[model samples]
Target: MQARQDATARAVENADNLARVIEHDITYTSQLTDLSIQAAVDGAQDADVMRLPDHLRRELLFDRSATASQYIGSLLCLDSRGKIIVDSTSVVPRSVNLADRTWFTVHRDNPKLGLFVSRPLQSRLNPGEVDLMFSRRVNHPDGSFAGVVVAAFRLDYFQNLLSGVKLGPGGNITLLQDDGHVILRYPNDGTPVDENFSGRKNFERFRQTHETSFLGTSGKDGKERLYNFRRFDKLKMIVIIAPAARYVFADWTSRAWYIGIVTALLIVGMLFAAQLLSVEFRHRLVVEQQLRDMTRIDGLTGLSNRRSLDDRLMLEWHRAKRSGKPLALLFVDIDRFKRYNDTYGHQAGDDALTAVAQAIARNSQRPGDIAARFGGEEFVVVLPETDGAAAAVVAAAIHAAVRGLAIEHNGSEHGVITVSIGVACTDTEEVTDALGLIKVADQAVYRAKASGRNQTSMAEPFGGAAVTT
Candidate 1:
């Protein structure tokens, strides 16, 4: 399928080159037409050419010396034909009728040759008058009517012009009539074609896009030549044709099966390489993220470990120190965990630790606060921007929350897991060292155990001042 598309694309390219060649020919012809008519119009605008005798019109038209040195030669005239005025050395005349034409109208209406333009065509000639019409009109200085100017090729110009142009090697370009009739062709397919084969079953591809197409056979010689065709809207349907296999690019596409195969393989290889690289990268990233998470998490309980809690305490301590705000720390431990483990199995002890860790995590109120299992049955919390008073309230809440747990603790004194909490508050002076705050909070936890288990206790803000209950 790709090979087929490649062939089609090559055919289109061949057609495009053909169109350009034709367009170049048209442009050269149009420019020549314009220059010649301007010369004639200059003569008509002159008092000499305008007022000269009809016999003297030729002398004035062709008399370059009569004008300044800047003027080029004028359009040459010939043909002893009476009604069909003939021209020599210029464009191909393809249409019939000249006098009542638009060129004549615009020539009469507009004085500037630059204003209006037309395409070349056959001239309608009659016997007696030897008349001719023009492809374009030129204007007089005062906007009055000027005469028509037609091309008079030097000699067999169309034949010579078509023959001289070089299409790409393996590519052959040709000119045609609107009906798909060959007017000019490379490799010289001299057979004349019908001028009415347009918009038909035979030439549907060419009709659609003015594009190049490959037909099976030209049928004239039944030879296989790639067919690229174009039709001119301005010329009432003149067509230009070119064949593939003569142009250089056509040769490249001749091996399209091989070329397309290489390109497809390269694309597939690149995609597979990209897929492999992405899979490897994703696998590495997943493992790396798990490693990072494990460093901060307790293995037995899914809580932030002690290493993370130490970092969190220092962070809150520094924040309180700079802002002159307060920081609070809570020290938590499962009441009589060692006794419970001795009485029950280590598995039961593990269950008690998990329940205690959950209770502490649930009690942390703010997102900025830290809740971590600080090794064994001990847990710690860091509360930022909180004073001694606020910390006490939070500590009380945690104490109450743990006591209310309905965990089935067969070895616990309270019939379930409970934690004793020690709250310590710090001011800027005491926050100088985060470890100092942890030590005081730990000492408070010892006080809670000494006074009575399963209760909340607090330490001084900075100095060893007596804490109010």
Candidate 2:
């Protein structure tokens, strides 16, 4: 009787150790996957997917996470109505409406549900394969539901991870949602995925506490087994490792000395695997950060891209509004750029553009200021807390810097490259929002061009004349 009791205690201890290893693996995977989804969300907000071309939009929203992770089946962005607007798998999203899907509805209905893990379900995109989805809610600037960013993982991936460990006869590993829905089970015994075990007596213990290991009867097979379970409160996940009590006792009786040595070796191997995964997780985070930084910069001139400009403009607009401080915008356009391209080859034009962009970047060196290539030969400089006069001084400095480069532009009357500058300030009564400010600044640019090629023009205050410097 004493020997039997000792074997049971050893079984419980082994199962508990194994459960901790599985929990570590899963927690890391989930955190990394969620981080990828969040990156997608931030990208979506920075770029307007609706206006972008299919391939460009997909590239903007999904990064290496889509293709780099072996376990991830796909990454997706759905619209407010649950229409798939962006998909990582194809340039063009599949024509599928997931309005009825539980994951979609949960996010759409619950604004505060930051991250969610869905029950296992067959993938609609990949017909034969089952998936477990990790999703986060997307919201508009006003906090209305915009959509969801989803990362789908193949159910087989979890099953394979769980099956790697050797368990004696009638041994099994199960992953469950907090609600007791089985996500995956190793050595599948024909039990359905997503089968609810909340009502089972064995699961009752898990609901009552964070971790446990004991001998209990199998709720399904009616056989005695040593069960070990661990719960992740934040992730709402549960992992269970169970081996039949009969097998444990028989093995212990026949080779008690060998059992301890084997268990030690298995534990070491699992710990090593966990360490490797940790290293991989940290490496992925670094890669993701680099990718995000790449997206915000213009490839040609090394200036802030249009997408980045939009985000910064919106952010500054709100800050200026709240603080009641003046915000200034400068619109700089290369004088007769098309003629410059015609006179010099496209490569020379690119060089000239880069030089001009650097000049503009140099003048707006304030920490709060942003200089961006608006598009082509057009550039914008955002100056926070600056009035029209200060903005014009910055614009004049940019004008002088371009003239200093003295790049030959035979197409221009000056016989050298020059730029037209338009300055606008939010202190004007007519400017109501960031878009309005941009429009005013653009009109000022046109006025500067109309006056001459190398000058600065500031938008007129209400009921006043335009200022040219």
Candidate 3:
């Protein structure tokens, strides 16, 4: 009963943390998009890009493109009548009318709205690909509506932001309009998935707890997930980070297997000893088993400690060499964690660390995947038979899981807790020792931390430079 209660509490806490992390990231990105579109409007006004002749509009767009790197698609300036006046990607003067578009209509109807975000739609220019538009109302000097200035960012832009986060085969992250229209889902399977939860109880639940997280089942995939409903009011959307329940409890499942085997062995030993040995001998055997278990687990996080990880890594390393398969190692560190400890006190810091460890464990789904608390705020994962690309997928999942924790951190630039991950993998012939693999992974971790926190970096097998993702 105590174990069950503890597990429930941890699940609830993890759900809340994941919601906060998604909210923070979506809010931050929305603010950036708002700023980007606003800047484009200001730039258009300053450069007279809107009023320039059609022949020269292309030139203006070229100049603008040279200086900006924010938008993944293109920028557009539309006339009050809905005719395209300037397009950044268009070389020929194309006659496209975007007057019927929601983004354009919303701004035309409500000029007071600083920015308008559209639901995911098929791109008019980039056909077959979905796009989300960020638009701002462009006004004349006299405050009359001139047109709409749009920054059409491809849906892939948002997808790439989460490309690294893989939650096993069933894990998914979704972005939805506040109205519950599905905008994006990761692991693009090529089938058009209309996962809109609008008009359903789940959508209603989202409206009720826009700032919090709750447990729910996904209507699209039919998986019970820890759901977070975070609204970016400015962007008119909500981001949901939902890892399937099975994946979330994977570590617990692994521990259960270990416990079950040990219990069975102990039972058999006791039965045999009942006929042939003394009672004190059976008690001593039980005590020895308990001691062995203690040595392998980290008390605070309930994860394998460094000692366990070392043993597991050595075993996996030899197995990989014998099978001629790849062995992957990931070194994870909470970014700006010292400042978090200083601000939140050690107890809160410990809680944060525990949460981080749990996130790592949840994402390391394979039975052979070893997640260990490697002292303080650092954690490690040993991925047997996993190549660099596959390890990167795990790394992304770990990043997403930790970011989901969203513990408050006043000192970090992100204003919330985040993690940096370093991934290193070796084919059988690349390294003769596990220590060399650890060194490579450790170097990648430093690179990830140094470049920026909340990102993943990978090291080449043969000690090449660390590459940030």
Candidate 4:
């Protein structure tokens, strides 16, 4: 049984690690692919290389694919003026301005070879419109500077590449522009070109970063998405990969029969082991709870002890600080505990104290308040998110409750057992630590005892005292 539990734990850990590994592997692969494509695009960013003219380039590369066996790999074409032309008769974008073509740049000003890629044009000349254009400069047969030469590539190659890779179940990959337009998606959901999430927050952020990824809710189905992105300079596009956790986990359930059989055998062993563990766990839990109870509770009055008082004070002090509200601490002491305990057999004295503790607890009606036994006949109550006036009213209730308890001690001078209460409130300024707040409340307690017994005394956070004794 023990071994089975260990095996189950190990399996869970292994599965979690494997999920992370898979995520990391796909993220890295996407990053590398993006870099390679960008490198190809950057090679063409050179203005001088793009200066090649179309007419001269067509002449140089005219049917070169026929003579050179392979794909003419990349043909560089040039015009008479040595400038590259980007005019395409096909794929006329309705809203797009042709003057913005990258290939028409002043490449001569920065003469350097560049690798480039251009989207497909809708024309019979560009039968498969997606074109990969590589541009470079060289001298002509006459030794004069030749026009820029561009090698046109078909888009079919990339369409195949995007679909070929093995991304896990529900794993998605897309290429978009830094300007927020998504160029393409794998496992096509058929989102239109312009109507998609072009102006979303992600697109706005894309320009500020070269790469980005996050665990977020998917924009498509509102499901959890682990999104990874890489920016490609060659095409001036950002590539994003997203994997859904729910769909990924669902695959394991599809093979539930096999998993269930194994789990059944494991469960039998776990039950036996759990019995042994539960025995030890329960015993320890009981002892720990007893110790905790003792620490917080008063020995004589059966009320919350000094430790609880300190803890409550700390909580209330911090709460008041954060919210700009106020917290109140009330300290209560038996008017004559030592004398009463000495005169009455400590038994009767203990009874009187217990009565007061119960009364204080009963009177602390607010949900945001605590009444605790501080020590040796002394007690404290904490009120959180409160103001000075609120505290004073609570303090008065505590005083009244103690008197109403009607527990009589023949030795006491008063008709029955009674308490002197001190109220200190603060919106939390000047106190350096939680302990400082307690000290201020204790000072109020002292003043209440000084004024008289069976009454209440209130003080400003750090100032004048008012007595109701």
* TM-score, one value per model: 0.50, 0.52, 0.49, 0.41
Report every candidate's CA lDDT.
Answer: 0.61, 0.86, 0.76, 0.59
The lDDT leader among the candidates is 2
- lDDT per residue (tens digit) for residues 1-469 in model 3: 4554565467657655655666676667666666656766775565466566765755654454444445447777787888877777775545889899988988888879887777777888778877777788988787778888887767666666777766565767677877778887776644354456777766687676554556678666677876655666656677667667777667677777888899999999988887576667788899998899899999999899889988989999889888988889999988888899888899999899899889889999787999998888888899998998898898888877777887888999888888888887875234559987887777788988788778888886556655555
Give the clash total for candidate 3.
2
- Those runs of model 2 whose alpha carbons end farther than 4 Å from true positions after fitting are 1-5, 47-50, 66-68, 208-211, 251-469
- On residues 1-469, what C-alpha lDDT tens digit does candidate 4 reach at each position? 4444443344335434443443454344334433433333333344443455644423333433334312223333334354334322222212322223345243433345343334433323344344434344444455344444445444444455565554557667666555565556676777643234565555444445533555556667677655666655544556666666544445454456567788887897798899889998999999999989888877777777777877777777777788878777788888877777777778887788788888888878678778888777888888787677887787788778887877765656676778887776674353466676667777777887777667777766457777785
Task: Write down the lDDT that model 4 would get.
Answer: 0.59
* Candidate 1 lDDT over residue span 150-258, tens digit each: 4332212445556755655544555554556544445554533223444544365666655445554554444455565565554433544545343434545557757
Runs of candidate 3 with Cα error greater than 4 angstroms are 4-33, 43-71, 189-195, 209-211, 254-469
Candidate rank order under TM-score? 2, 1, 3, 4
Q: What does the lDDT come to for candidate 2?
A: 0.86
Question: What's the true lDDT of residue 238 in model 1?
Answer: 52
Residue 304, candidate 3: C-alpha displacement in angstroms: 73
Clash pairs, model 2 backbone: none
